[model samples]
Target chain A: MKKLLTLTAVGAMLAAPTFADTLRLGAATAQTGGLAPYDAPVMEGIHIAIDEINAAGGIGGTTKIELIEKDVRSDAAQTSIAVQELVDTGVSALILPCDADPSLAAIGIVSSAEIPAISTCASSPTLPMIGGDYMFANFPGDNVQATVSAAWAQEQGHDTAYIIYSPDSQYTTMPLYFAEVFEKMGGKVLGQDTHSIGQQDFSAIATRIAALPEQPDVIMTSSYEPDFPSMLKALRSAGVTSQMIGSDGIDSPTTFSLGDAGEGVVFTTAGYAEEGSPLEAFNKKYMDATGSESQTVFNAVGYDLIKVIEAAVLAADGSTDPKALRDAIANLENVQGATSAITYKGTDGMPVRQVSLIRVKDAGREFLGSPSPDAALIPAPRMQ
Target chain B: MDIFLQQTVNALALGGTYALLALGLAVVFSIMGLINFAHGELMTIAGYVLMYCGIAGLSFVIAVPLALLASVVAAVLMERIAFRPVRNGSGATMLVTSFAVAMILQVLFQNLISTRSQPVLLPAMLSDSVHIMGMVIGVNKLAAIIATVVMLVFLDWFMKHQKTGIAMRAAAEDFAVARLMGIRANTVIAGAFALSGLLAGVAAVLWVSQRASVDPLMGFMPVLKAFIAAILGGLGSLRGAVAGGFLLGFIEIYLSAFLPPEMQEFREPIGLGIVVLVLLFRPNGLIPSATLKAEKV
Candidate 1:
């Protein structure tokens, strides 16, 4: 009987899994280039999320999630290379931040590998339309944010508004969404202007806005931080002080540093860390680890992505098969996370969560409660 | 009318920054026969130095000069370590070396400083706006323009009359012949880099004062503009580079101001279009130097 027991124990030891049994996860993020600002916060989120999972005994009881990072260097070609390398390394799923164009460039490669891919931040509607079942975004697309922001402005009694946006794919589409919603809500867009990214001086645009016969009650802009401040400075210098509103891109520390010029500039964004939210705990963890505030939406997304992956892994019930893991992620319904309750309803539906609208006051951001659904349009009587 | 005048003043201020940047590029290109792509990185380095000094409790006045001095030292070192060895090498080799140095500097900056953009603080007076003729103007921009003009004038005098400057010019004109005249090739090249870095340092001050922020890649736009300006003004001519800088600045600003809002983003491209037109008409740039005649042929 002792000899039989010893043989059984040796057989059990031989069946035990090694590091090769762990599931590999790859992140192809903007490690360089223009999008680095957004990418950095997302990476931080990924690290925090992954750490939380590992601490909780990891996935499937036996297989831990192993993270491998590759800097796409913010190039489309590099993104493809990074994704292929990660897939080649046998990662079960690939994660990326919210850059629409570059993310699109990597889709063919990702799909060809038969590996599940999710963009934690890429909110462009084009992604889902293109990748079908293979692609998912953790956040709402630009249209949703734009719709919500315009609705909020109308609720605030902003009837006459000036719209300024870049013609670039990301920024241009956002303000167009706002304009469509605002006009439908009876708001008269007094003027529509366009500027290119990286064009510093906005004197001409400012002058045009100032010269309008009917001055806009609010000025809405869609651009990133670099040009946003300069635009605001030019407007302020010209004494054109229509209340300014920006898209999610305005949620940057650099926006506030525009000094008095950036005062009262409000914008919309996904919730970062609100009081009594799970993210508050995550924020504390981030601060402790990174020694800096997780200020952007990317931070929260980063934190939550790890949770989503871990949840999917646990729900798989000790299965390390890639196909099983992919199905597990797709079936994630109402998983409560620090950022939001993430649910995947396949490729055809929106994530069933509300978007947050934030405001800049005294050079700091404040979450102004979740916008009302009707906030996308002002009441019809006030539109005139 | 007031707005137009204000726009012109804005153009002039922008032109000043451009002139300084172009002058730096021209100095290095003329002496070394290679464009120092790292020239913009030199500006970024100096800006960071000023930022460090300011954080260390030095006044902007003291910090600015110290930063400029540091830039000179860095430029001299770069010449000695990176450029000097490759001096007699092919133009492509020197160009590639400069690009390598720029990449190294960019990575160093991103690792050491927070890659996230940070605001560059300036003294209160530099940020304040002044009104003239019913138009608003930034006092700092005005100061930048004046400083640029003064530096240009000083540089012109030095290049024309100073013995060292004359020898450097001689080297630029004919390096082989200048060596025969007992002009040390290393001295002229080192001086050129020093002067280039000095101008870059000053330009950084003006640039950071206006933008109020600094990042690792902040050098990119300015450097590209400087390269274009150097070419537009005549590559081998220092005065022409300064002229090209101001001219490019004015053209960019004016185009942005006068064009429709939809076309404002195209201002730089429009300015470049004009430069192309000038090149097509003149072939050797707007102010071709006599020394570059053989090269053009």
Candidate 2:
């Protein structure tokens, strides 16, 4: 009787649609907090991709994609809870917000569950090293951006530089990588300083730069948005006439508030154009649906992640199994994205891509250089 | 010689900002036995007020007092609406209530504006620096030092001779006794919040001036620094708060200025040494209270 019952169950399973199940993606990001502005766009991007796939008769012809989101509120403890709940509900993969704070909080739990996860904007090159094989960062690797930033600075005839780095690893890594690249290219690092994140007063740091015996040709930094403007204003107001260069951290409208203080500041960040590519169409769709302008490059990254995931799933021959998806995503190469062409190196498992060189001029961002294929690639780590 | 002079100005400006914020927090704690964690939100509201005024193209001189008035009004309302109801509650309850108010204000600000820090345009003249004695000092920084010193002196005089001020001091020392002595708790608390708000507004201008931006959580760091100073100076001691604030800022700025490039990252750890020093030799804080000094500060 037991054999007959098992045979009957198998028969019923066979009668259902072949390879049919909802491909569940868990998003553990802040819904309300400092990171919400970043998180909302990524979630929308994922939804946009899922809707596109599902509209065309779903993945594998019958399986639809469902998103499970828990508002971690940028809280670490809440992130753990959200991760546990998402795993218990059986999500195939997990996605994190762009910034490092809360997203790094959730990646560990997902790794332990043997589930695959990708970060939208956490740029630490060291993430994949510690994140196990199950985790990947979708944003351009920090090392890649730093190298390009150095090359761009050199191209602009900057032979000497000073740096003020953010205290956090995710932020300071850019300046760190830039230092590596700078020294490699025979540039002198006149001076370097580190400031704690959220430090509003840059007068002391500014005075240090001002008091230098000979001002460097360029001043570089790795700080994001709010801190970026404060640091720039202080340095500029302190009579340090040296030009400034920085990472994507300086790509904030807030930097423009200080008028001439922000003038001539150069930086590197993600890019997207809406002229001739599918990104243009997608941008229109996104704006129409969300009723809000895209806040930063993370919006494009969010849109790109969904497309990349779709490609990876297809590369796995339409399998939503975590191990299969993880392998496929790790090996994803030359996946055309809205921001740029993204390719994950099999050696380190981080996406390598190009960034736009932007110059700050009178409260506006003007493109200084276009994407360079040679400059954008992340150099593989050498075995010492 | 020039470098030394410039760094001194840097330290002085930084200290003045810290001292003002510390005094703001200390004012409420001294009178009400409340830490007033939501004190920072007063600054945030003020920034928003200035931002809207700037949007209306109001001159910087006109915006300053308007921002101050808005901050004071917000702080008074906070005391009336949030604190007055929980005025007699346990310490933990009052703290939690303050946190709740802070969270509410934060969310409201976020919904009304973007979570991202919005730029606050100041008068271009604010950025102008005066180079005297071969060193440049930002005008805003110079103004900050003057404002802080003036406010502290005025506060000292008011605390020493004014009727409401003495009642506040009496309430801080012994609330029950002060009430028995015909002091109305309501008037004293409102007055304390008003003064606290005014100081926070001054600190806000200094902060917004430096950052050129404002966001809902912009007040967070200033408030934290203020709390640290208040504790380091001796909780509930106004003079101690001022002394601790300046000392904290000086240590932080000088460490950054003097530390070698290789060791500059240790700036924060070195600055935090004040907390250790306080905990060790002077747990009551580095300065004695006004009452202990036998002279009103």
Candidate 3:
């Protein structure tokens, strides 16, 4: 009887499936180009997270994560080629570029290969909707970000709002969503205008705003960097003093470079750099590694992506199969991330994340608060 | 009436910058029959100089001249190093070579300086607005208009009075005849590039003043507009280039001011349509050069 029992246990052990020693993650990102400003920091954050995980004996205490990175050179065609090469190498998952249109190139390749991919910080909710189920965005969707900005604007006793947006990209059209949520929340939309992405002259737009019957109580735009600062200067120079509300696109050093012009202006970001918080710790780490303080909010975003993926790997019980990993990621909830608690549960592909409101003052960013925008008030993702 | 006047100031300010850039392109094209697309890089070079000047804590007065000089030097060097070798080549070769030079300079800017926009803090007074007859005008706008007018007047005198400038004009009218008349081709071409660079430098300062920042691609849009303006004005005619620049600016500003808010996004397309209509009727542009010639195929 003892000999028979020993033989039965050995047979069961032989039947069990064993996980691979290392899970391969393919990262096809822009290392040099326009997207490099955002992608480089995210890549650094990912490297930090990978180091942390590997030091802790990897995800699920055994299955190590191996990152296979390729530079897409910020080109859509290069993105497709890079993704195909990575997929051919049998990567379990993929990390894509920071913009929706560019990431779509990789998404098409990943989806057919049954691999899951996530954008580093693309806020466009329409990204996943167009890229199919295998694609996910690890950042807050544009709808959620706009909702937060509008809600905050309403709470500040502002009633009249004007919107200026660029029709250039999904990210720049954030003001469209802001206008939708602002009006829905009982705030009146005075008007909305469009500017091309690279437009340097905003004097015409400013003059039109100045000619309005009554200046708007607030002006909202989703423009970034050079454009945002230029617009602000033009508006201020034209004597349009209505408060300015901006989305995450304005979370840049150039915005604060406006000096007094940038004062009291509010914008949304992924997380606040609160003292003693995990975000603060991560910033310290980032500074130590890169010899500069975090300039944009994407570093934390990159960190959160890896943590979410680690959670998914844990949930999959150490299985590195693409389908198993995808299923686990879709169901992940309350995963502790560097910036906030991340949840991908009960949504198409956008994770429910917190939005941080920051105000520019004294030539620096002041953390206002991280507010959870009301879910019911969030507008549906607009198809691009 | 007040709104119209206000928009006019806005138009002149923008138009002046465009005219400066357009005139820069026209100068080189007239002399060499080559549209130096790398003219934009000259503007970018000036921007970087201003940025570095800011970093060095130089005042606007000192920085502005230094920036202009840097642009002049960069333009001369660019022609000497890149354009001179291709000067004797086909028109297509020169055009392609200019594009290659522009690309190389852009890449160097991205790699050596930064792909991100770098801030250049100008005097706060530049952004201040003054009320005049119920119309608010930016100090920078006033400065732009004044500077453009002064530069234009100076260029007119130089072209007519200065020996080197007259030689440049002679070369523009007919390079082979000017060469036969003992006007050095190399000196005249280099002089044209230097003048173009000076105009771009002036425009760059105003451009940076309005935005208070610089980037690798900062000159791309303005240069493109300048190219369109040059085409709208007779490509080889300096005066025509100026007229085209102002016209383009006025059309764009007026369109924005009068167009319904809902149709604001169509401003560029509509503006371009007007340019096309003008070109359809007057193919040589608003002020076609008297020297414009056709080669027998």
Candidate 4:
């Protein structure tokens, strides 16, 4: 009887860890706050990726992905605690949305744990430089978009550009970088105005922009979608006729609903649901599966992020070891994706990929084309 | 000079929105002595109602009234369900309950209406602008200012002339004494919440028109601003709340204009700094009421 009891205890101990082989994926995002617009789609994308990967035989052939989602509620401090909770649950990797400061705060925890964390939409230049090798961003940093936007404006013969940026971290840096490039390219910056993130009235700034010796040929604003419509509306109401240009943050259906006020407003972005290209195929799959259109680029990146992780796992010869998978992901090159040519260069080099410049034309964003490397005439010091 | 005038006009327009928000918040604070943390959420609920009505094919004219009535009903129900249960409880209990109510409403809105940003469509007239004194003013701004002035006048008249309103003021002054005077304490508290809802509804219309969008979290900033405005004006003084709202609005815009472009983002901080200065000079706020006494319980 004693020998039989010993054997049973041993068997139970052996079986427990096999059951624990399930791969845990953590998602820490702004589930309920101002950033919900960006975070919700990213969450949807993560779930879709998990479902697809699990269906196609998950990591190590047996390990299934289990998602543990936590709401950071748009507070940077709360994100640290959320990440810690995920770490406690033995999350192998984390998927985050486009939050710059919060991501920076959680980087140390993720790095120390040696877990690979990929942010679906955070494109701040500072991210790559500060996060070292452990962090990866699915999209090109804001500087790349800023460089392309300045070149596009100059290509359209806009010599005088009025730039407005939110003093909030992510949006501010993008326009500031673009201004640096636009100035380097011999285009005069008429006036550089800064606004607080949630300021409803843009009249003072609009009045100043309008009173310039010569009204700017183009006004470039780097701000999120919620504030962009009001800023544009105020600018137009104040009789400032300068053509408005915005960054990737403005690419949403909400922009079109701004009605004629958003007409002639040009912005640079990567994905649009209306385009029936191969890119739209992925979007269509997402829509068909979820019964909702993938309206933003973050959703595509979310899908691509899971695919990249899957590819990395396969490339590592079925190694579920975190370090080996991390190395494989860092060494990713020439990987074709629905949105762009993704190449995950290690901490030392930039990720060389093709980024598209899209414009909102006639109430929907249309793909302009791939940004020509040589066509980008401006040289701004890369901050990241 | 034109820019200066334009900025001042902008300040006045913003002030109108702040004043209405402060009025709504102050009404609840004065009568119930319960800081309705959910006050802004109530406004958001009104905005959502309007959005839903519009989606259901109701015209803006009909939608606005329906939204306002819904908001009033919501506020009254909240008083009955959430606030009334904790009426005689500790302040901490009341505060936590209000926060709980806010979270519940926020989650409900997220699941039901939308978790993403949605534009608040405006009528064409509200979107039009008229140039006055070299400053551009939208019809929306003019309407907001007119609405605020009329509401303030009507509120003053109600408090001074109406029996229920006088009883509410008496209750706010001393609840025990007012109870002895045959005032129904529950009715007075409910009326205060209803009034708050009415003001919130009007403010929601003005605020949504400015952003042209409404989200579940839209109430957050406005609520914080109104709280600060009420404290700046005097916690229990309705007139003081109005004064503080306009004061905060002017200071924020003035700082935005005078400060360097890079520093314009510090406008809120500057406004708060002024508040600190005011508190240091006048601890009871700009306009204090003699009847406003600290509660022992």
- State the fraction of real interface contacts model 4 keeps: 0.61
Q: Write the per-residue lDDT of candidate 4 for residues B187-283, one digit (tens) a residue.
A: 8999999999999888888888777777887887788888888888888788888988898888877787778866665767776888999977777
What is the DockQ score of candidate 3, to 2 decimals? 0.54
lDDT of 3 by residue, B104-213 (tens): 89878978987667888787888899998888999999999999999999999999999989999999888899999999999999999999999999999988888787
Q: Compose the digit string of candidate 3's lDDT tens values, residues A304-357.
A: 999989998889888777888999999999998889899989999999988999
DockQ of each model vs. true complex: 0.42, 0.63, 0.54, 0.62
For candidate 1, give the docking quality class from DockQ: acceptable
TM-score of each: 0.90, 0.91, 0.94, 0.91
Top DockQ hit = 2
lDDT of each residue in A216-294, candidate 2, tens digit only? 8888788865677778777877988888888765556666566877778877887745468655667777787778765
Q: Root-mean-square deviation of each candidate, in angstroms? A: 5.8, 4.5, 5.9, 4.2
Show where candidate 4 strays beyond 4 Å.
A1-24, A59-64, A88-90, A273-276, A346-353, A373-384, B293-297
lDDT of 2 by residue, B1-297 (tens): 777788888888888888989989888887777888898999999898888888899988999999999999999999999999999899799989988998999988877886767778888887878888888889888988998899999898988899988988898888889999999999999999999999999889888887778887777889999988887887778888998888888888888888887788777877787577764777677775654333323
Q: What is each model's TM-score for chain A?
A: 0.88, 0.88, 0.94, 0.88
A1-384: candidate 1 lDDT, tens digit per residue: 756755643443345323234667889988666677778788888888777666666654456667889888778888888988776666777886567778878889877876777776776666656765666667766666777777788889989888888766564446667777888988988867777766555656665666567889888877775677777766776668788878766667677655666668887766756677877887888898889877666787777777777777677775544566667777888878776787775534235345777777787777777653553342211110
How does residue A205 of candidate 2 score in lDDT? Answer: 86
Error of 2 at B115 (Å): 2.4
| Candidates sorted by lDDT, best first | 3, 2, 4, 1
Q: Is candidate 1 or candidate 4 better by lDDT?
A: 4
Candidate 1 lDDT, B57-111, residue by residue in tens: 7898898998899888888898999999998999899999999998888878777
For candidate 3, the per-residue lDDT at A344 reads 88
Fraction of the reference Cα-Cα interface contacts (below 8 Å) that each candidate reproduces: 0.21, 0.70, 0.60, 0.61
lDDT of each: 0.75, 0.78, 0.88, 0.76
